[model samples]
Each structure stands twice: as C-alpha cells, then as structure tokens.
Target: EAKASYWRQLAMDEIRRRSEYQPNTRRARNIIFFLGDGMGISTVTAGRIYRGQRRDGSSGEEGCLSWDRFPHVSLHKTYGLDAQTSDSANTATAYLCGVKANVKTIGVDSRIKAGQCHTDKSTHVSSIMAWAQTEGLWTGLVTTTSVTHASPAGTYAHVGHRGWEGYVPNNCMVNDTKDSARQLVEESPGNEFRVILGGGRMNFINNTENDEEGLKGNRRDGRNLIEQWMKSKEGKSNASYIWSKEQLLSVDPSTTNYLLGLLGSTRLPFVMEQDKNCSSYPTLREMTEVAIKILQRGPKGFVLFVEGGLIDYAHHANRAAFALEETVGMDDAVISAMKLVDTKESLILVSADHSHAFTIGGKPERGKDILGIGGYSTDGYPITTLSYANGPGYNETKVNYTDAETTDPNFVQKATFRRYLATHGGEDIATYAIGPWSHLFSGVQDQTYIPYAISYAACFGQFAGSNCHTCKTSTG
Candidate 1:
C-alpha cells in the first residue's frame, strides 16, 4: 500500500504539472482557438447529458466540465449579413476576420467591385493566422474536416465564394488560372504555419492523377506540396510530410522542423469509424497532440487552430448518436491540449460558429433501454420514442415504433424520428475560454464579441472593441 501510494502520488504530481496554471512562465504569446464546428448550445448540453447518463445514470451535467467555469463567456449573433440563418463560411469569417460578411464569403469583407453592380471584392483583411505569421510566431491548423473547407479556409485564404474548390462555376470568377481550393491549403506559407494536418487531399493535388487509395479521383498535383514544404526550410530546419498513420507516428519529432499530415482524402472518418480502425488511423486527439509538439519548437510561441469539424456534419445529418460521440471526441482533444500548455501565457478558446436545430427534452430514464419501445405512465399517458423539429427524416406517428426494422431500417431511414416539438430553442449558445486573459468572457454577448474578446484578452488582434471592449472596459 505504501509503494502504491507513492507511485500514485507521483502520477498525480505529473498530471498536475502537465495541467498546471503557470502564468508567469507562460510566454504570453501563444494562442489556441478550438472550434466545435456546428456545436450549438443544445448539442453541447445533450452531449454532456448523454455522457453523464451513461456514466452514472444521471444528467449529463454530472459527467463533464461546464462552460460556465470559464472566466469569460459570451454569445454571438450568428446570422449572415445577407441571411438570418448563417453557414460556417459566413460565421468563420466573422469570428476569424473580425468582419461580418455575406453568406458564402470566406475571409473577405464586402466591397462592391468597381463598375460591377452586385459584384464585390473583400477589402484589406488578415486572419489571426496571417497576423501570427507576420509576428514571426509558429502557426499550425488541425481539423477533423477538410482543411480547405470553409472553417479552415477562413484562416488562410480569402475568396469571394466559398465553394471555389479547384473547379469553379462559370459565373463565379473571372480568373480560371488559380484554384481557390489549392490556394486555401497552400497560401499559409506567408504565415509560416509549420504544421498543417487535416483532410482535403483533392485541394492539394492536381485534377489529373488519382489520390493515394480508397478515393476515386485524379487529385494529385504533379508537384508535391509536402516535398515543397520540406525543402523550403530556414537554416537547419527540416520538414517531414506524412499521409498515413504509420508515417505520422514514425516521423522523428526532434528532427522534423515542420510536419504536414493529411490523413484522409476528404474529411476524416467519423470518430466511431476511426476507433474501429485505430491501429491504422490517428484520432483527433492524437493529431492535436502531434501538432502541438511540432509547433512548440518555435520560441516566439505559436498559434494553433484545432477543429472538431465533423460535429456539424453529424448534426446536419441528424445523427444524434454520432454527433454526441464526435462531441465527446472533441472533448478528449481539449483535455489533451489542456495537458500540454500552461494556462497563464497560453489562451485556449472553445466556441461554435452557430447553433443547431437540435433539442433535448424527454422523460426517458437514464440507461433505460435507449433501444426499447416507449411506455405510458402509470396514470395513463403516452411517451415519445425520439424527436426532432424539422428535417428530412421525420415521420409523424401516433404510435410508438420500437422494432429495429421499424425504428431504423437504413441510414436514410434511420434518420427519421418522431416529432416532440415543432421549433428550435431560442436560447443563446455557450462559449468557453481559459488561460491568459480568459477572464474577459463572463456573461452573455453577441457573436461578434468572440473574436475581439479572445484577441484583446490575448493582447493580440489589430482590431479590438465592439462588444468585447464594452465587457472588458466596463466595470459592470
């Protein structure tokens, strides 16, 4: 028992050291912005509740960290400039660029093109990534989605249209020379982002050759971007680009000055799929850990953006189980990150671009047979099996449906659920932040306040103020 106690104490000390809040030792230079891509307040709440219920047959709140624990918290109005309901492109531009843009815009502002009515180009703008690059800080981007997707694009590229993925529609742009998607992935050189890991092999490769394997397309650019990145080293710096899990783990972290790992052809496989094939694929947490290790080499501190990009896709598909699992997976990444950097100098901000149409309301007992048929109250009442507001797979049924064949026959059929409500919640979504000046987020504020809050708190951002300034400057 004494020996066991000593070892346990040593382990606890090590964990505490990893998760320490060392403000003074911190460089006050590095920033990590983690985005849970379509994770609305409800999704988070449900995820927490589901995980909690699974653990102890209690509300999800019991099993996880609450966003309220952050020193600062704020809300953002997620509507696009042109539309009330916003997409990732518009929202990412707002949060990343500090400008509210029209729907489908990446990192550009709205300025009508000369002599062209209804046509415009975004004015001078720079993403936090670009700013960090200019500041000579090591930068990196990690995501579970295609790196060229809208959310990640906001970090590196600026384009008028979001869907300019290599192939451009005729009416979109005049230049047929440059592929927007390719530019989005490779343009980060100006920022000197040492590590770029995610999906979207198609964006990097040419439209002439087939990708590695499991994908059907000629997307390999004749010039390998990985090799180019490796060769463009400064002084003794070197880079190693890996596409497979085996390659990623085998690379020498001490020798590799820069690392580019693009695991999948598009967005990575969902968490469940990855878990089943864990031996061959790195999980999101693993990717984040490796990126952090590589980026920490720069003494000026670093800027890293790690995204749980698949949560949005799962929510869009109305796959609540998959979405919740993804959220948990994202949480694991966050936990891993927290173990890496001290809370004082490093700023960790976790937020979502917008809310989802998801909800959580039912009297279902904890662990009370998720796959079972609904039952009536002893006082004589009807119960719901599953519920949704609006989506393609909803079927209105007066009777309970429990059989595997009736409940979910196929992927498309599995999406269908009974309606318990007709509307989404009007409540604001939640934001979480810690480290450095995380005290800036405490109460409710607009979505626009998020970027400024993080920037001002971190002592960065050329453009500060609007809602965050009001919160930080005001005493109330």
Candidate 2:
C-alpha cells in the first residue's frame, strides 16, 4: 500500500509538471545539439537504471535523465541513403548537413561514392556550422571521439571517405583533394571558430612534433596544421590553443575570441578508464562547460555540437559497463550544459547517430544490479542482463557466469555469434528537443529533419525570414 501510494504521488507530480509546461515559440539564439553516438533506447534505459542504482542506491526505474525532462520527443529513422542500417558518417551527414549520403561518406549528398576522390567536390553539402557561420553566429564542436572523427568532421569538413582525416587511403591517389584535417585547418576558415574542443591531436600536428601525451602525429604530408591555425589567429585577440585541462580552465571567455583545445591525443579517455586524480584530459562535462562559456561570448549567439562518442566505442567492444558509464558521462554533460543556457533563447536537441545491436533481457527483480548476471538459462547457462546479437563474446564451449565479474570494466557480455565487432542496429532512435520550435520534432521524422529543424529554428540557411527574430535584429 505504501509503495503504491509513492508511485501514485510520483505520477501525479509528473502530470503537474507536464500541465505547467508552456512551449517557447521564440526564435532560438543558440543551439546545443548533443549526439550520443550509438546510444539506443535500450542503452538509455540501461544507463538510466545503472546510473540510478550506482549513484542513488535506488531501483533506477523511476530516475529521470536530463533529456527525460525535454518537453518534446520523437523517434528518427537512422538508415543511410542506400542501407537499412546506417554508419556514423552517413547519419552524421544526414543530421548535420540535412542530406542523406552513402555509407562512410561525410558532408556530401547521396550522389557521392564512398572512396571515389573525383566526385568529392561535386556532391559536397554544407553543414549547419557553415550556415551558422555565414549568418555571423559563432560555432564550435566537442566530442569524446577524435575531433576529425565522422560525426565532428560532418560539422565542418567534407571528404569522400570518413577515414581520410589525416591521410588519404593508400590506393587513392588524388593530389588535388585535401584531407579532412586540411579542410578543418585551412579551408573551413578554421580561425573563425569560437571554440573547438575534443580529441584527435595527431591529425593536426606534424610527425616530428609529439602531442600533449607524447603521441606521434599521423599526417603523411608533414604539415603541422595546428601551427598553421595558430598563425592565422596571430592578430586575433584572446586566441589560444590549449592541450591540457589546466590551461582550458584558465582561459577567460569574456576576453577570448577563439579557443582550440585538443583534450586527448586520440579519442578522449573512457569514463571508466580515466584516472581523475592523474589524467591529463578533461571530462566531457568539463569540456561542455568550457565550450558554453566561450561560445556564449559572441553577441550573435552560437551553435555547438557535443558528441558522447565513447558510448559507441564501448558498444562495439560489447563492454556493457563502459557503454553505460559513457552514457552517464554524457548525461552529466547534458545536465551541466542545460544549466548554462536559457530555454527561452536556446534550442537543445539530444539524439544518437545510430544504435548498436544491444539488448537487455532476463528480467531480474526490480532494483537488481543492471550489470549483474541474470538467473540460469533453461540450458543451465547463466546469462547477463546485457548481451549483444553478435560479438567477440561468442564462445564455442559453454561457460559458467555464476562467479564471473560481469560488472568489471573490461567485461564483455555473451553473444549469439562471433564477429570482429558488434554491428549497428536498424531500429528507430529517439530524439529529444526543447526550446524554440521544438514542437516540430513531434512524431516520427527522418534523420534529415534535424538539421532542417535547427536551421529553421535559428532562422539560418533556407529558413531565414522575418520569423527569425535574432536574425532580423542582428542583420538589420
């Protein structure tokens, strides 16, 4: 009776919160789009429950994430232009450029082939960052993956192949075409970015110059792009290039014009692997805070993209704890970012580029450890709550999970078949939105709708008109 009363009161509170909600129809002055790469609905549910269980000692089912409070929510189709299951490059292109492209292609429409160098120039598509830049709005990008990785590259760089971040493939001999690194540093008006924080330092520096962590640069052309970017910003005030957390925190946003921070040598450290007391990198939440502080300095407002990319890496490895922890890290960043912006002037959208074929089954009692193993199967094998459709976890021989450390950071859940890496799922992914024109996100929409929605809400790109209050006031 007491439990029933508690649940009833919770439901009533949710109802009241919903009843009090009033949609803000104002033009968005800023847009903070958070992409949790490979975070599916199942991943969110498991991460929510796991985080709640670990942080609050609660049952976890009732706990709400920062995005859970978003006023509008919708499911988006994640398939590529040609394939039912999408890759990060295709999905990133879809949502960032508002055009669906073939797998492994970035910042180009469907006509471009994945690795054909000649077609790259003709099929190029402009991203929201380019549109935002044209309208005099400051723009930035942050991610747990390499800054040159598919999702982040989608914002500013165009390439035939996503892997051509620093160097072109061995077989492809296109001397005229520059790599994603060159595009970001030289072609995209790199010095104009208000804030660019994330990983992939090796792609920007030369082979002789080591990264902050003593990691060798991978650029074959021997161009130190970071040095080039710094040279361009020489006359610009408050232009700083940072590689450490201490330097990042010391910068004054009020006095800063451009800030480029590469927080990791490659991809940022996973939340589980990061040694908080000794690590050189900043957490995702810290990076988001610094970015918001810097970008909000512009009088014209800004557009920032934050990606929780480690979630996908963990999922690919079939590491449930790592994936869930990464999601929790992303949630923390989202919560921090939400507090920094006003809903009246900012539109925040949270979604995933794609999903992994992960599942949570073998229903244990409520409040049970989400990472713990479920009861024994009918075949007398203990199964975990988290398992993949196919992965490195597949074993030919039966194994006992009764005493295995399933919750360990390195633990990989059991799988039905063996594969080099767990594959992406084809199901619809959820997109949560709030602030100006968020209502347009209602109902199932194509992934392409996101970039359009952002462009429209901010009154940029093809949607620029009298309805865009910020645009009209700033331009006039």
Candidate 3:
C-alpha cells in the first residue's frame, strides 16, 4: 500500500493537468513530420517494452517512448485505393500528397495504376512539401531508405510504379516519365530542398560509375545525378554533398545552406548490424539533428519529413528484434527534435504508412526478454513472444528448443506461412501529435486525413489563408 499514494498522487496531478488544458491555437511556424514506415500499433507497444528493457534492464512494460508522451493521439485506417492492405508507395501518396492513389503508385491520383507509365500532369497530386514551398516555407526530407524511396518520393515524384526508382524495365517502360532519381534532381520542390539524406545511391549514378565505397550503381542511364545535384547547387546555395558519417556530422548548418548525404548504395544497414564505432553512416537521430539545424534557418519557417524506413525492411525479414530496435532509434530522433524545436509554435507529427503482419502474443510474464520464448505449442515445442503472421521463418516444422538461440539477432521468429518475405497487415495505424493544433489529431481518421490536418496546423495549402491573429502562444 506504500506505492498507492504515489500512484494516486500521480493520477490526481494528471487529472488536474488535463482539467486545465488549453489547446495551442497559434500558427505553426515550423512543422516536422516523422513517418515510421510499417510501424503498427503492435510495433509501438513491443518497441516500448524493448526500449525500457534495453535502457534499464527492467520489466520494461510501464514506460513509454518519446512520442508516447504527445498530448494528442489517434488511430487511422491504412488501406490503399485498390488494396485492402497498403504498400509504402500508394500510402505515401495519401499521407504525403493528400490523395489516395492505386497500389504501387506515388504522388498521382487513383487514375494512375501500378506498373504503368503516363505522360499526363493532370493526374499529378502535389505533396505538402510543394504546398509548403508555394507559401515559401523551406522544405526537406530525411530517410533511412533511399531519398527516392516510396515515402520520400511521394514528396516529389509522380511515378506510376514504385519499383522504377533506378531503372524502368522494358516491360514496365517508364520512358514516358522521369524516374524518381531524375525527379529529385531535376524537379521543382525536390531540387529546391535544403536537406536530403539517406541511402540508394545506385539510383542516382550510372551503372558504370562507382560510389564512394567502390559500389557500382544500377542506373543504365549514363547520367551521374549526384554530381548533377551538386552542380545545380553551385553558387546558388552553400550546398554540401557528403557520403560518409563523419562528413555528414561535420557539416556546419550555419555555413551550409543545402545538404545531401547518400550514405549507402541501397537501403541503409539495419541499426543492430551497424558497428557503432566505425560505421560510415549516421544514425536516424544524428541525421535528424543535422537536418533540423539546417532547416530551421529559414526566414519563412520550414517543414521537414524524417522517415525511419528501415523498420519496415527489418519486419519484412521477420527480424522482430531489429524492427523493435529501429522503432527505438526513431524514438530517439523524435526525442532529439523535441529538445531542438519550440513546441509552442512548432507542430510535430508522428505517424506510419501501414503495418506489418507481425504479432507479440504468447503471454510472457513480467521482466522476460521480449524476444525470448513465451510459451510452448500444443506439441510442447517452445514459441517466441514475437512472431509474424507470415514470413520465411516457417521453412521447417519445429521439434527443438534446447538448441535454439531465441535471443540471437539472426533469429527469425516463427511464422505460419512459408512466404519468401513477410507481408503488410491490413489494419489501422496510429498517429500522435504535439504542439500547435495538436488536439485535432484525436479520434479515428482516414490515412489521407494526415496531410490535411498537418496543412491545417501549419496554415498552408488551403489553410494558408487561415489566421491565428487572436491566438496567443503558450509559454507554459
């Protein structure tokens, strides 16, 4: 009963705090959108436990991650125009471009189908980045995936096929349209971005050319886009192009007006796989800090999109440990931004494109390692606390437990199906918000409601005409 007073007092304080709460209605001068790719509610819950365990070696069930502390939260359905479950491509169109497109399409309306090429600009739907620029707000994007990947590409590219990032195959023939790499370097909002960071250098360079690490690119077109991006920024801006961790962190945001860092040839290595002391790429948190430092220098304010894209990649491989770790890494980035930006006039949004077919079942007890075995199957064989609904892990029937290393990083949790890769889940995802207009984020919403809500919060797009003249900024 000694702890009852402590819990009661905490509850009373929280009640008092909520009872006197006033929503911040001030015009948002800055907006930061954080997308945790394929981060479902399950991922967040498990990630919270994993984070607490890793940090304090405790039971890790009671604590919350950084964004979990946000004042407003909502659950949003994540379905594409054609598919019940969504991929990053189509969903990116909704969340970033504010329009739902067909599966595997990006930045175009539902008129564009996946794997098809179109020459029409009429079907194109512009992203918030473009809208932010229309109002002269500085814009940028950072991701663990290549900057040209689905979510980032949604901010700029209007391609019909997501796989056409590097090259357009003969059958898929993207000859009529620009590939995502070309779009980033040659397009309007993309070329004007002050900061761009991530992997997938192969899509930006010629197949004959080698990246900084001697990795050959995959682009059949002989054009070297990285050099072209540099040339575009020459004299016009104090642009810094870097390809290593040391170079990225060394960049002085005060001196550099434009930044581009392609740290990997494809998607970045999963966080757990990177050597902390010698890895050449910065963590998502490090990239976020540098991006913010540079982006916040705008006179008209800025909007930045930082994506933890590798979380999806880890889940697809049925690596629950890595997926949860990536989520925690993203939480670190969110925590860093919270300290760097003033929440009174700045709006920070955290959301996901979709979810993976993963589960955290088996009813393990308190303080147990999240990745450890939770219970035994009907046959008396051990099963893990984390397993996918479907994945490559079901290649064989299980009869062993004594020789198993359930906690190993390479451990692929069991799956029900024998697919080559896991699939996305057809379920609702959550969005958490803080700062200006954050209260509007509560309740169930469609996935496309995200960009519109952000626009409303920041007073851009249709809401640019919005005024907060009577609203006073909160000091507390």
Candidate 4:
C-alpha cells in the first residue's frame, strides 16, 4: 500500500517529464530500424519487469524500459495480407517492404504465393534499405538470427520460399535463380551494403568446405560466397570479412568501409547459454554499435536494420526466461543506439513482426521473482507465473515447479495445450519511435505503414516528393 503523497509526487514527475519533452522537427538523415521478432506488448511488460527485478530487486511493474522514453508510441495490426496470424516472412515484408505479403514469402508482393517456384520478376518488392542505397545513402543490417532468416531476408532476398536461403530447388524456377546467400553476395541492396553482421555462414560456404571452427557448410552449389563477397569488393572499397568476435573488434572502423561479419554457423547461442567464449560470439549490442560506427561515416547518412530475432525462437520452444532476456537484449541495443546517434538527425523505430502465445498472469505479488511460481492451483500444485497457450510443456497432468530450478535456461514453462512448438499470436503489436516525423506513428495503423512513415521521414520511396535525389524511384 502507498500513501497519497507517493501517488501525487509520481504523477507530477511523469507529467512534468511529458511537458518538457519536445520532438525534433528536422527530417531524419539517418534511419535505424530495430525489429524484435515475436516481441508483443506482453513480452515488453515482462522484460521491463524482469530487467527491473534483476537490476535492483524492485517490484518492477512500474519501471520503464530504455525505449519507453521515446516521445511517440503506437499500436499496429500484424496480420499478413493472406494470413490471419502472420509469420516472420510476411510480417517482415510488411514492415520492411511496405507491402503485405503471403506467409513464407520474402521481398515479394501478394502476387507471389508460398512455395511458388516461379513468378513474374515485377512482383518483387524493395525494402527501405534499397530505397536508401539507390539514393546514395549507406545501408547496413545486423541481427542475432541467421542473415538468411526471414526477417533479414526481407531486406535483401526475393524468393518464393524463405527456405530457399541455402538451396534453390532443382525444379523450374527459370533454372538460374540464385539462393538468398548468393543474392546477399552478388545482388542489389545486399551487395551494396556497408555492413552485414549475423549468423548462417553455413549457407555461404560450399558443402565440401569447412569454416575456421570445423563446422561443415551447407551450400550444395559449390560456391564459397564469403570469398566471392570478398573478391567482389576487390579494389572497389576497403572491405573486410570476419568470422569471429576478435576479428570483428580488431578491424578499424575508420579504414574499413565495407564489413561482413558471420558470427555463427546458424543463429547465435542464447545469452544464458553463451560460454564466456566472448572470442567466439558477439552480442547484438556489439554488432549494432560496430555497424553504426562504420555506417555513420557516410556523408549522406545511413539506414540500418538491426534485429533481435531469437526472441521468436525462444518463444516457440516455450522458454520464457530466454525470451524475456532476448527482449531485454534488444533494448540493450536500443540504449546503445540512443547513446551513439544524434536523435535530431536520426529516426529510431523499435517494433516487432508479431507476437507469441506467451502470457504473464496470476496475481503474483509485487517483487515476486518473475521466473518463479505465482501461486498454487486448486489441485494443490504450484504453477509458474509465465505459461504458454500451446507448446511442448503441455501434459495430461500439470507438472509442479515448486522445487524445480525455474531460473535454469533449460526449464520449459507449462502450456495449456500440446504443440511441438508454440505458434505466433494473432494480435496487434506495440510500436515505439522517436526523432523527426515519429509522431506519424501514433495511433493504430497497418504494419505496412512502418516503411511508409520511415520513407516520409527519410525522404525516400514514394514519399520522396518532388525534389527527389535519386534518378529513379526505388520504392514508396
């Protein structure tokens, strides 16, 4: 219980803070889009509370996340053009390309269908990264998931199927369509990128080849695309390719204009599972800051896409602790970006592709351990505060976690129904923004509005207006 003075003072402080806040009116020269895959409003609330508890053992419910200070906030519908509940591919296409696409499709419009091998090339859609690059702006991407994964793939790859990342079917897709990794190496926006940092190097190397870690490659096309990417940069720019954390930090951002960092064979290990082997893996914060340091050198500024993609993975696996930690990890990158960039000249947008069936309920008291049990069930079994709608944790009988180590990374929370993996939730996601034109993001808008609003602020795509900089319009 709190007193009247406490409530009044808290309200006054918040009101005073709001009154003093003023948005920057100038058009943004730099655009940084941060995507937290599967991070819904529930995830945000849990992560904020979890972070607060971890930081100071506070009640956590009243605390704010790093991005909570952003002056503009909104809610957006997350359904795809063809899906009542969307996956990463379609949702990424919506936010990144400003087009609602079918599930399992990336960088293409509704004219493309899932698993369709061949389609008219005109159906291909371009993302903000392309629009920025065509305007002579530096472009880059960073993520904790595979660079070939659906979220990042939307920025570069135009494939009928996201699984085409490493292997294009031998079927009749016009016989010469390259895989996603090859596109990143040899094609448009991806090739023109100033920085590329993420996992999935197995897709880049030949099946016969091995990386420095002795991990076998997955590419059956016999192309070492990493080497090809390096060769393509020959005599064009001071490009450097790295496969380890030490290599990433050793390269000087002042001299290296193009950087490709493949940090993991697949997705990077979860934070809790990371072996103090800092030399092997790089945090999302490290990759983002490094990318910003190099990309910020451009005279015309830059557009960067940074993703905390593993949150979705953890949620599907029914690991609530890891999901919440990954959410906070994204906020860590946001905090770093806020410190590194000039908000007056940079527009920072933080949002999610969709949500999970994860929930945080049960009248757990204030300061209760977020990962611990909430209360006992009527049957006399203790249940955790966190649970899922459907996942591997489901059983005919509820399992008791009363004496279990709920904090363990391997611990899976209970679910109401059985599913090998949980599915995405069909719900609106919260969107946060700041910098110029961020107010346009207020209120409920379609997910496709993300790139549109960004384009308006950065002066690219269809919103470039009459005095456009590019000879040809890249997108709108």
Best by lDDT: 3
User: What lDDT does candidate 4 reach at residue 385?
Assistant: 86
Candidate 1, 124-218: lDDT as tens digits: 35777776665567888898887778888778766666665444555444543234455643455332668888887766565665567656432
Cα deviation at 69, candidate 4, in Å, is: 1.3
**Tens digit of lDDT per residue, candidate 4, span 195-280?**
99999989999889999789999998788999999999999778998989888888888888999999999999888778755537
**Candidate 1: residue 386 lDDT (0-100):** 38
Return the TM-score for each candidate structure: 0.79, 0.95, 0.95, 0.95
Pairwise lDDT winner, candidates 1 and 3: 3
Between candidates 1 and 3, the one scoring higher on TM-score is: 3
Clashes of 3: 0
RMSD of each: 7.5, 2.8, 2.9, 3.3
lDDT tens digits, residue span 1-476, model 2: 26898889988998998899777767789999999999999999999998899887898977888898888999999998789999999999999998888999889877777886743466788889988888889999899889899999999877888999888875565556777878887776344678889999999877877886789998887799888988988887778899998888898888888888887778988988878688777889989998999899878889999999999999888888999999999999999998999988899999999989999999677887888886778898887888999988888888886535887768888888999899999999999998888888889989999999898889888877655645455434
For each candidate in the order shown, give its overall lDDT on alpha carbons.
0.66, 0.87, 0.89, 0.88
How would you encode candidate 3's per-residue C-alpha lDDT over 126-221 as one tens digit per residue?
A: 999998998989999999999989989998998989988987766545444689998999998899999999998999999998898999998887
Q: After superposition, how far is residue 469 of candidate 4 from its true place, in Å?
A: 13
Q: Ten-residue segment with the worst summed lDDT in candidate 4?
A: 465-474
Give the Å error, residue 314, model 1.
Answer: 0.9
Q: Which segments of model 2 are wrong by more than 4 Å?
A: 1-5, 170-175, 189-191, 467-476
For candidate 3, report its TM-score: 0.95
